[model samples]
Target: LLGDVKAAGTEVREEYRWTQERWDEYRRLAEEMEEAEPSAKGLIFLDYGKQTLTSDGRILNEYRFAGKVLTQDTKWWGTRAWYIDEGINRIDVLYARSISPDGTVHEYSPDDITFSEPTRGEVFFGQGTAMSLTIPAVDIGSIVEYGYIDEEYAPEDPELFQPRFFFQSGEPAKLSKCEFEVPAGRELFYETFLLDANDPYIGQTIKELPKFVGTPEPVITRTDSSTIYTWELRDVEPLIWESNSMGYTTIAPSVHAGLYPDYSYYHERFGRLHREHIKITPEIDSLARAIVGDLESEKEKIAEIYHWVQRNIRYISVKGALASRFGGHYAQITLDNKYGDCSDKAILFSALLEVVGIRSYPIIVMTNDAGFMDRSRFPFWGGNHAINEVWWDGERHVLDATGNLHRFPTYSMGDCDLYYANYVRGEIVYNPPIPAENNSMQSVTLVELRADGSAIISDSMWFTGDMEAGYRGYFEYMPEQRHEMIVEQFVSQRKAGGRLSDFALANIRDISKPFLMEFSYEVDDYTIEAGNYLLLEVPALRYSFPEIELSDPNFGKKSDMTFMRTHDVTFTLADNYTVRFVPERFELSNEYFDYVANYEVDGNTIRFTDRYRVKKLRIPISDYAEYKADAEKIMAYVKERIFLSEE
Candidate 1:
């Protein structure tokens, strides 16, 4: 079937296989497309996708598209396809041709297709190639349509299959469809998620579905020995990007289909495969020993090895069949290359820990805004990142080696409060939330009010846990000169005419200690003078939370609002001035969060200390009004000022 499809085209090319002539032609066509259509950079008219799965273990996937080239931006619409390693999957161009505005057809031949390594951005290990060709005669107002078939053979797990269908894209699609077919007796399950609750479903399926509720249950159907499912949506408007969104997968209407029976079955199978790839060799043992030499404690040894990989190995992104999708390279390959993607780094790091007699496993996780996994919905393929989980002192410590600038023992920010599937343990788990103390920022600011209203300010800050990781990363790659400039700019922003005098940083490289930064600057006309009184506006020494307006129509319409942070600041006055007034001490506590602030005057110095804690990671949308009221009280307290007068 795959061969017949390839033969239907004028030329058939193997996946990722391209000639030099074809490469030149691709480049030439890109230039031509750019010159002809500049505004059409993001124009995509039609995208049709299909996938066919057979009970015998053969999967064929194909994508077809036709769109106008309005500007250079639309050049990306040219032909491109990615496939796993040929050893595991075979890809062929069934047909690729373009129609000009004049209705002339230009058919591409297999000899004209080119193959090369897919670009890896910040990934270290990659295994697979890309086949791409820019359709000829692609000009303004011209319509181009091309498609290819990617057939994957999974003899090892013939019953394993999972497919996701996205109903929306960056550009509005005039028409789109998702089709799947499986041989008889192969049970099929599916669930559909709609971004907006108000959007209606327009797609059709052979099997009658019950009224859509929350994520509809899978509709099972079959004709004789084969089961076929089809969903079609037309005139889908582009998804509007939202700030702090959970990503397209969560926001767009889509369907997830799988053939596995349960989560444990999928977990155990994938875990076994991952374990096979992380076998520790003699070289790995020796290297681990060298890296952790004389490190007495288990914690120290783990930190040493984790930091070693982060500091030594560079991260490069590789999107291919094995490394990008289902499998990863061996530990030895990643160690020798000194570069690997998240999975490669995780595998090598896990192996190194194993050699040192430490129990560790590579776990799959979704980073950033990929959203959380639904354990109830078993056999779902959702995680896009891999990290290591080490068992030490009867506790599990989650570590991500990809954070090159992060300190050990501290998982990346936002990593907590999410679901993860442990490959070694063969179970799904939630990462423990970082304690408020662990994710804290402490700062002391000294303010000297001069007789002339000019003042000098010095600040000392200490960051720990995830907070430390963020600053450490910033300082690790930033140059000394740039650091100085950034400090100057920071001070200037707060004190309109502030001039940086001295700056120093400590404990940046010492991961065991909290990261510290100290800087002093002088601000001209820092205080307003009226008669014998000095008006001193308190400077915000730490990050402030943005105001949440409960009045907004869409406020709390989607996910909950959750964050944790602590900031402490102190201010002092010169001996020449006596403090006359200060904001009263106050405390606010609620189910979702708590804020405690106090102010005191000791001789010529006034100290202000406040602590804010978010008790719940997510506050239900229904609780937005209450959350906003509590947050507003904190904002009001921060706005308080102090008054001083010369004796």
Candidate 2:
């Protein structure tokens, strides 16, 4: 085929630019190969990138580890297969350490295959870069299993993982190149499928490998003419289930088990060094003074600094291998360079705030990577983000410097709180924004019907600290895309029973000082059939706790838990209305607890009121079940109460 193509086409033809008809033929052949055989078990291959031994030989071997599995009975392979080209010029050293349920480490050789050899062999077309990865297995696990594949990827390598042969990098690839063998007694059902790659170079590609019964099997194939350095893999499932997936899960509505910092020597050193060397210069002082002039409120001053950094800095995600080198140090250089990741922006904001009278702490937050932050282990190697915590007027405010356009009133709390394990490092650690200080508030829909068959309703909300920070992140950072996302989210949640006729945001206001967000939207043309009325439930609308509780079954009682969120809403009925379901006013009255809910009606407007406070800093997991149940109960009450009537 290579000779035929070369002879048929002009020698001047570009590399990889095959004719359309020829490309289609190649794809067809690849498809046939893909539909090969059934390999029963799962196989993971490790090809750790190259390593150079130093003169002193200071353990460079331990430095280039790739992929961390969080499950049991995981089998991996390598052998000479780790060599990319088999020419001996480019080779990878593979090593693996599996952890037992009891935390015992077992090292394995490359030749071992504990389970059935599911997918094996690489197809070299006698020449070139085109290739494919195949996985053949049987239906055995749940769809929700957490599977992740992180290969040794470095962008500096020119030929590193470029998209070819119908694969688009970064996007989801749908390839059916393998067959699933159904065991005699086992059932077959696949609920969900997911493919993800953080690197942008490799195009996402998916080809279906047909499943045929008996001896005929499937294969994954690819043909590339270019010889480039990169890493690629096809993962079909997670190493462990979500329940056992380690790290921080959610952040906004304050959860107890946020991501804990890993207790590694490097982490401890980074924490200590960060805490020690975090500093601001006098030049920042002059700059801040010039900008603020005479802002009286500490909040305003802090907000100005936050806005300045966010506005001045641009977001550039340092991904892949370079992140490890670019992440630490160079905060000021990033500021000077005017481009940085989230942490760099945060550092600049903290520095600027320090220049003024307002004190700020440089906090580390866990992004999706590195799992959750473990507070119990204070110095856990946790978190992949850097944010700021500003203290003002006896209260601490969370500041995210990434989105400068969203300073003050427009705060963002979206996924920022999902797995927030934050700590104040350096001289500014006086009172960093703790999980306890976060709060979210939202009003529920209290729709009352009138005699004329029209409905009346109202809504209100408030947020503080981390919740405000989240809102700020969303409102300010992503102004262009915010309203659209908000509309979609609202429509999806509220328009469950009735078809969404329309939604419109009204009464827009920016109250940055107290950091409050207020907006109203109308859901029009909503109808409930007689005897089967419409019930619009209020989503748990806090940054964290209002939606779900941070408690566990093993831990019976709630922690020194903090409750913080407040809301108000009114619904105006059309006419001749009557109350159908009215929630009972409830209050939890323990020093450690802070909560209240009530409803009232005046004229045509029905008002729903709520309040919450935080008194404790930490909540134990032992009491999570009760807390979760209580939260559900409250949510049910709020959802159940709906004013109904007929014309």
Candidate 3:
């Protein structure tokens, strides 16, 4: 489709010439990485590749990697796919080629590249675009290299231009570098981070000012017209992946460059950009009052308004809406369309709360899963997502109405326990972490075993925090036809011939309370019956425990992390058969996690109770071995079964 459009990247005004010395260096690096990571598919000769920012607010990005494919699975690396935001930039494929083991070179044609919309998951609208091509005759042991450039012509705010370079990735690199050329009279602030995954001090005090994380050591070159700054790293190994580890962005060595003076610049600039659009019109006021309907407590009013926007406003991305990559659309326009994205929802919710006499400000968040956003690092556009912060009764509460599942004071786990930047508050503030008890799941199951090894079961499960948000969000967005099938599928998942009856859900749309699921189940054979004995265990609960595995070799070497998983279960049995044995109480407690399960039996009844809670968020490597061993015991305890001998 881009046949006639002018290509900016492929012309190759100046491209790197492959010399014998460069080729020899690549061979030596390839041999080193292949021996160290024999199981890896490929190794990069150059990563963080070629990046240059000109003085006129235009940026150039090019990656030239002479990487050897160790396996057939990665031969597709020769199939080029370049992501672009065509709305503001033009791209050119300067060069692409593949060199086989026997030194056969297959050069790719830049003219062969074509343009199409990028494949983002279910996102129907955006400035996202892509360029593609297929290099000929690439195979295992082939070294493929490619380069491209994208130039942004129109930047809404040139002063807010901040470019960050991440030097480390999952693929090991021989060398990675970023360079910038700026004109005289303009000074750019630069900070380089060198976070070590194995450093106990860095991991334990990541949120606090980390000592070894940041250093502005850029190589500077001066000329009469301009100055250049460069940052480089060599012999960089790939980051190791560990189970339950924090995001790689936390440990990745990176350099951030920005012209903005301080963090307040972001707060002031963003607030002013969207301030004109966040007006509370008569329509918004009427809607807000109607939604609250004389709710007296400020907290109640906040919940009513937050939940209203979540259910009423549809979430759909639009090009140029937040594509300027900051702020939101008008609150009135969002209410008129009955739909908006995350930023739009936050804006509308903020306006509605304002109408109800509650003080609120829109804020930006970098979400827990995205990466670590250190204030010590020069402040740029740190958050990838936007929400709102409210001040009520001398307390600060950060809330998100982007999804319908979360209740007041509880939000998506991603938005929980992170630092955020708000326009009103020029200083960065911390949103205190929600206690593990708030994000919990409680379940109850009653089983009655018949003489023929069949059982009738009644089940009810309750959810709060993220647990409530996930299931409720699914039901809210899921198709109506699939709802019944989803409920029925739970029965068969537990037992082969099981059927569900009297299934009911609570608070699916009401975000004021914990989400609840209640159902009755009947299974043909819940146990194996011998001549005089029945072998049975607790019925499989719908939600199982978090799969905690420390099998990865890098577990202790990588950053330690703890997930919030609090679960409580109670199982009651109604039967006349004499119980021969009851499993003893099993408890494992440590700084990492807490687990306990015990059983009680009386006359013709048996009660089994289980509770598990995560005690810490960051588990140091020193404590991991003990945590791993205890975790294994809990895994075994849950699967343990008691033999029943009938009278």
Which candidate has the highest TM-score of all? 3
Each prediction's TM-score against the native?
Answer: 0.77, 0.50, 0.87
Model 1 RMSD vs true structure: 8.0
Candidate 2, residues 204-251: lDDT per residue as tens digits?
111121121211111322223211212233322212212212222211
- Rank by TM-score (best first): 3, 1, 2
Worst 10 residues of 2 by lDDT: 250-259
Can you write out model 3's per-residue Cα lDDT over 1-647, one digit (the tens) per residue? Answer: 24423343344344454456756776777888789777777787765444455667666665555678878767877887766665566666666778887777777765557777877656347776787878777898988877666666555556666777887666666667777666666777876665444433353323222222233477888887777787777766666555455566655667777776587677777777657667889999999999999789999898888878877898876747332346778899889988777888888888999999998888888887765566645675657788888877778888888876678777766765567888655757776556667677677788887766678888888877777777887876778678778888877877788888768887777777777888887887777665576666766622232324544334332222223443333333335466766679987788657777787877657777777776455545455556667777777777766557655
Pairs of colliding residues, candidate 3? 9-92, 10-92, 10-93
Off by over 4 Å in 3: 1-40, 48-51, 83-87, 120-123, 195-216, 321-324, 376-378, 475-484, 507-514, 528-535, 541-548, 555-576, 615-622
Q: All candidates: CA RMSD in angstroms?
A: 8.0, 17.1, 4.2
TM-score of 3: 0.87
lDDT against the true structure, each candidate: 0.66, 0.40, 0.69
The order of the candidates by lDDT, greatest first, is 3, 1, 2
Of candidates 3 and 2, the better by lDDT = 3
Q: Roughly what TM-score does model 1 have, to 2 decimal places?
A: 0.77
